[model samples]
Structures are given as C-alpha cells and as structure tokens.
Target chain A: MLSKNTVKFIKTLHQKKYRNLEQKFFVEGEKSVLELLNSDFEVELLLVTERFFEQHQKQLNHLRAELLIVTQKQLESVGQFQSNDSALAVAKMKSNQYFENTQEDLVIALDDVRDPGNLGTIIRIADWYGIKHLLFSSQTAEFYNPKVIQASMGSFTRVKFYYGDLKEIFKKWDCPIYGAYLGGSNIHQLNKPKPGILLMGNESNGISEELAGFVTNKITIPGFGSAESLNVAIATAILCDNFKRLAGE
Target chain B: MLSKNTVKFIKTLHQKKYRNLEQKFFVEGEKSVLELLNSDFEVELLLVTERFFEQHQKQLNHLRAELLIVTQKQLESVGQFQSNDSALAVAKMKSNQYFENTQEDLVIALDDVRDPGNLGTIIRIADWYGIKHLLFSSQTAEFYNPKVIQASMGSFTRVKFYYGDLKEIFKKWDCPIYGAYLGGSNIHQLNKPKPGILLMGNESNGISEELAGFVTNKITIPGFGSAESLNVAIATAILCDNFKRLAGE
Candidate 1:
C-alpha cells in the first residue's frame, strides 16, 4: 500500500512545474515500467499490482527503490493511464549537463516542437536509429511530461535529451547541420552528405528564420502526393532512416 | 444561434453509435472545417465564429448547408478542441460501398489499427504519398472519430476509407503486398518492390496471424539503435516513403 503523502507527491509530478521542482517523473504501463526497472535510471518509488509483482518477483528483488504492491485501480487514479494493471515507477530525472559533450555522428534536434507526444515519438525514433543525443530549443515540449514518457515507450531510457538555444549551440558546432524544410533539395538526391545534426521544426511552422542560416543543408522529403505536410515525428524518422542508410552505404 | 435541438443532435454524433445511426459525423477546427466545406462530402450544418464567417465568407456563401454564426466559446463548448475559434461542420458519412473499385498503383491497408489518432495520422500519410485508398480491418478505429478528423488535419477529405476483412480483401489483391514486420528483408535494400498494397498492423501487435499468409514480402525498417519498435503510423509513413522513393528510382 502506498502512503497518502507518497500518492499525493506522485500525482503532483503530472504537471510540468511539479516535475521540475521534484526533479522526478513517473513511467506508467506494463512495458514502460518494466523498461524503467531494467534501465539505469534511479527509481525512487514503484507502485505495482500483485500480479505484476508476482510475475517479476526476481526482478523486484534487485530494485533499490521503495516498492509497494498497490491495486490497479489505485494506479489508474494516480497516473494518467486509463487502464494500467502492471506498474508505475517514479524515477529521478537525469541532469542535462553531460549530453552537451556527445560526439554522435548524427544528432537529432527539435526547434520549437511543442507537442509532448511528438517529442516522445522522436525520442523513440532517435533510439531506433542509435542517435544518442537530442537537442531541443527552450520552447520545445518538456521531456518529462507523462505524455512524452508514455509515447517514448522504453526508448527514453536509451536517448539523452539536452534543452538549449539551438542557434547558440549550432554557431559553435563545426559539422554540417541538416534542416528539414518545405522546398529544400530533395532528400533522396543528396549525395553522400556528411554526418552532423538533423533539425526538425515546430508543428505549424518550419525551422525559425534565425536558425535557417545555421542549416548547412536544407533537405526535404519530396512528396508524391497532395497532403500539405507530414507529421513532425514521421518526418524525423524518415530523415533518420535516410541518413543512417546513406552512411552505411 | 444554434437551436437547442440542433446542439443536442450534434453532441450525440460524438459517439460511434450515434454517428452510425444518423450517418453523420462532425469536423472541427479551422483547417479541417474549411477542407470539409471544399470537399465533395455533403454538409448538413456548420457552426462558425463571426470572425471565421467574415474570413471565409465567400467560401461559406457557396456552402449548401445551414450556417450558424456562433461565438468562439460556443464552438468550443460544442466541439472536442480545447479552443476552437473557427468552425465545425456536421457532414454525412460517405458510404463505404464505392471504395472497392479503387485501382490505384499503391494501396494502404490497416489491420486492426485501433487508435483514432494513429488512423488519422496514417490517413494524412496516405494522402502525402498519393495513396488514394485505405482499407481497414473492421476492428480498426472508426474513420469518423473526432480525434481522427483532427489528427488527419485536412487530408481526411482526400483519402477514401474502406473497412472489411483483410483475408477476404487480400484474397483478390493482384499486386505485391508488402507487410511490415520485426524482421525480414531490409526495406532500404529491397531492389524495387512493385507498387502494391502496404499493410500496417495494430499498435502493440504486428500484422495479424491470419493476414500474414497474404503478405508477399515481409519488410522491416532496419534499426541501428535499441528501441523496440516504431509507432504504427510512423512505420506506415516510412514504408510509404521508401516504396515511393524506390519506385521513382
């Protein structure tokens, strides 16, 4: 059974303000919670149903966090999930200090991408392509938002996130910066582009005019149809796939 | 001002049962409502803000439907969006009967892709790649769901949706059927897949066991990182991008 104070604290983390204040976020659902437990993230508290506990008893024994066997109803009430019968784990947020030093060949960056779901999906895409570092403009959605955490699946654990001014960071970087644009050169026609950062922009707007100068190469996923645009996350994955595939060639 | 009876009737269309019974669904937000008006679908009624009315007055004048200039607050109250200052249209659902005759070079099918948001995003993706027709398993989320409408942006107007059993439909599909899976041929390495149907599966589950036999080529987006899987919609777009890119080659 979870303490009343603990339950109250967990609920507070749902908001961005509270999550920042506490430096913690919760991962809900069976897959995410199980992934969290197996990850290097420091779990502070875990609320799990009896069935979840029984199913992973050996895994539970190794956890250093406070573990409470709670009802699925309690978890559903405390977390954002409509139905979560497995586990919910509150874990400490990793400090953003170390991600700046990343020397990854292909870095994924978001400029004013404000949707948490999109951010999470991008994180999963970054993970899938083995892109370790993600840079976000200050205006991007909070990485710790429960929506992002849930949408990221378990990939959040593998990807490192850094929130900073994209312009300032790009100014100091020496590598080629590929910016996704509406009428840029066709992505498929790019000839052996060098490794660097891939920047995606806001939902409604493309990359900001200020960041446009920093883009060494403006690329586009040439459309064969009449749809106005692809979703940001979908665009990100396609770009990542192309970059990785070209590099391997 | 909307009549009390009309407001009550519009509210009922939010649910699937009511939508089916009345053979009507509503499209909200400025972009979608404008697109809905521009499309060939039959609109029964439209609730618009005075500002929206003035901005698109010429477009609204051509509309054969009843138009009520309501306040933005009224539009918000009657719709699902947190803030909708534009318009909402109650339109008749197009019958699924005519879509079976589609002879497009490429077709997209959904096998129990049950999330309305995912379905909507896929619809937008389909529209982006110029895939005119989408076949859904009966278990897939309803195309008329409000979340689907909003997420598809305005592309919902361009794509035709058909819901039927996969096995039955594929039994007669003549072209190559590429199915997304965990492991198979690498999508990037495929020489040139002939234009055919691209089938995506449910969120958690891959392609259904019954439908696996129908797959002529099992292809996957080879991952360079440790993430488990991409979102279904994201996968669909990537596959569509690859297929179109390869075809153009």
Candidate 2:
C-alpha cells in the first residue's frame, strides 16, 4: 500500500520541475528496476507488486533501499505504463560530471535535442560505440525525463550526460568539432576521426548557423533517396558508427 | 466545414481495421501534405486551411485532386495532431507488392517490429540507404499506420513494403541472410556484406528461434558500455550503414 505522500511523490516525478526539485527520477519495469539496483545509482525506494516480491525474494534481499510490497491494484495507481510491471524504483539523480581533462577521444554534444526518446536513443547509441561523455545544450531534454529514461533502457547508468552552454564548452576545446549537416561533405570520404566533439543538432533543424560556423568539420550521411531528414536519433547512430569505423581503420 | 460523415470517416482512419477496410490513410502536416501532392500516391482528398490555400495558390494549381478549403477550426475537427497544420491529405493506400525476383542489392526484413515509430524509422533508414524493398512479417506494424506514415516523413512514398511470412521468403532467397544478434560475430569485422536481407527482430525478444536457425550469418554491433541493448530503430540504421559501407567499398 502506498502512503498518500508516497503516491504524491511518485506522481510528481512525471513533471520535470518536481523531478529536479527532488533530485530523483523513477524507473519502471522489472528489467530497468533490477538494473538500477545493481548500478552505482542510489535507490531511494523500491515498490513491488506482492507477486513480484514472492517471485524475486532472493534478489530483493540484496537491496539496501526501503521496500514496499503492494497489490497489483496499488502498483497500477502509481505506474506510468499502461500495463504495470512488477517493480518500480525511485533513484537519486546523479550530478552532472565532466572529465578533468575535457578533451577526449570522441565525445558527443547535442544542441537543443528536444525529444526525450531521441535523447535517450542517442545515449544508448553513444554507449554502443564506446563514446564516454555526452554533452548537451541547456535546452536539450532533461536527462531525467521519464520518456528519456525509459528509452535509454538502462544506458543512463553507463553514459555521463552534462548539460551546459555548448558554445562556451566548445570554445574551451582546441580539438576538431564535427557537426552533422545535410549538404556537407560525405561522411564516408572523411579521413580518420580523432578524439573530438561530434555535435548533433535538433530534429527539425540541423546544427544552428551560429554553431555551424564554429565547427571544424561539417559531415553528412549522404542520402540516395528522399527523406526530409533522418530522425535525429538515427542520424546520431549512423554518425557514431561512421566515426567508429574511421577511427578503427 | 466538416460534414458529419466526413468527420466520422476521418476519425475511423485512426484504427487499423477501418484503414484497411477503406484502403486509405491520412497524412497530416504541411511537409507530408506537400510530399503526397508531389508523389505518385493517389490523394483521395486534400483538406486545406483557407490561409494555406491563399498562401500557396500557385502550387495548389498543379494538384489533380479535389481541394476543400476549410477554416482552421474545421481542419482541427478532422486533424490528428495536437495543433492542426495548414493541410491534411487522405492518400489511397498502396497495394502491398512483392517482386518475383528480389532485384535490390539490399533489403530489410522486420520480424514483429511492434512499434509504429520504429517501423517508420526503419522505412526511412531503408530509403536513406537505397534499399528499395522492406519485407515485414505478418506481425509487424502495418505500413499504412498513420503514425508510421507520419514518422517516415515521406520516405514511404519510395520504399516498397511487403507484408508476408519472412520464413517462406528467406527459403527462396539465393543471397546471404544476416540476422542481428547479441553474441554474434562483430559486425565491424565482417569484410563483406553481400547483397542480402538484413533481418531485425522484435523489440524485446530478438529474432525468433525459428528465424535465427535459418540465418546464414549472425552479426552483432559490438558495445563497449553498459547499455543492455540498442533501440530497434537505431540498430537498424547502424546495420544498414555498415551494409552500405561494405557493399559500396
């Protein structure tokens, strides 16, 4: 059974303001909750269906957080998904951290990436390609947005996301700044990609003109057919894959 | 003004059954509407805001379909999006066509890709990579789904999607079958990706065991970070990019 305050807190996590104020975010579904528990992220609370508690008794014993086992009906009231999963967790949001040296081999910077799903997918892609640090413009979707967290599928635990002014950050670095553009040089023809910041822009718009002017290299995924533009997330994956391939060779 | 029957008819398009029964789908937003007018797709009706008609009178002259200019309020009554765009188009669904001989150097076969957005993104990715044929299992999202169509961003106009049993189709193919899996050979290590079908599977459960047994080669995108899995759409793009890279090289 959920206390009135607990229910209120869980519901409040749906909004960015409340999530930030509390410095916590919710992870739903069995896989995400279990993964979060095993991660370095601090779990504030764990809510589980009574059936789940019975089924995963051994795993639950390892958790250090406060646990509450409730009926399915109780779980459904606080669940975001249509079908309530067995477990839900509220974890403390990690502070934004940047590496000491700043200049690294392949960091990704997102400029005004508005879609939470896109942001999450990009983070997952970044993890796949081994790109460690992800820098985001202040206007990008919050890292704790429920949709972003859900789309990440636990990648958030591995990838570091820092939100700040991209222009200010890029100015501090003396490395190559690659920006993905529509009519730019074909990405395949580019030489080896070194340690630098690979910048991706918003969904509807490519890199902003101000940022585009500062970019050291403008690359594009050459299109053979007509698509208004690739989805920002898809574009990021392709670009990251290309960067990895070039670096490997 | 939208008639009672017209409003009812437009609303029905939201459902797959009604869409199939009518053999039509809706495309909203200015970009999609303009693309439909330019494509070979038959536009059954064009609902335009009076402001849009006045703004683009020159371009409207070339349209062969019946154009009904309505007030913004009337457009909202029949529009699917949150805020109604200037124009909405009702396009006759293209018949699912299968080629006797798979002529495309590369094709994509999706096995029960449930998300409409993922399916649409895959179609757009296929289009971008110049893969003309996209074969879908019977369980895959319908290509004519409005969300899929909208997400494709006009790429659906060029990519031919066939809905059928993938197992039957693979048995007939003379080319290599590349199935994306987790522990398979690293995709980057493959020297050549021959003209073949790249099979992507369900979001949660990967390629069904039945399909996995039939694959000639299993490939995995090597991951270095803690992400459990890549989004289906992102995975497809990475695979397609790699395929293009190897084939073109």
Task: Give the Cα error of residue A173 in candidate 1, in Å.
Answer: 0.8
By summed lDDT, the worst window of 10 consecutive residues in model 2 chain B runs over B97-106
Q: What is the TM-score of each candidate against the true structure?
A: 0.97, 0.95
Docking class of 1: high
What lDDT does model 1 reach?
Answer: 0.89
Per-residue lDDT for A129 in model 2?
78
Give the best candidate by DockQ: 1
Q: Indicate the worst ten consecutive residues by lDDT in candidate 1 chain B.
A: B97-106
Task: State how far residue A117 of model 2 sits from its true place (Å).
Answer: 0.7
lDDT of 1 by residue, A1-249 (tens): 678898899999999999999999999998888888888999999999999999999999999999999998999989999998999999999987535534557999899999999999999999999999889999999998999999999889888778888888998888899999989998887887788999999998889999999998999998877888998999999999888878874
Q: For residues B15-76, what per-residue lDDT tens digits would candidate 1 score against the true structure?
A: 99999999999999999998898899999999999899899988977888998999988888
Chain A TM-score, prediction 2: 0.94
Candidate 1: give the clashing pairs: none
Let me know the TM-score candidate 2 reaches against the reference structure.
0.95
Interface DockQ of each model: 0.88, 0.77
RMSD of 1: 1.4
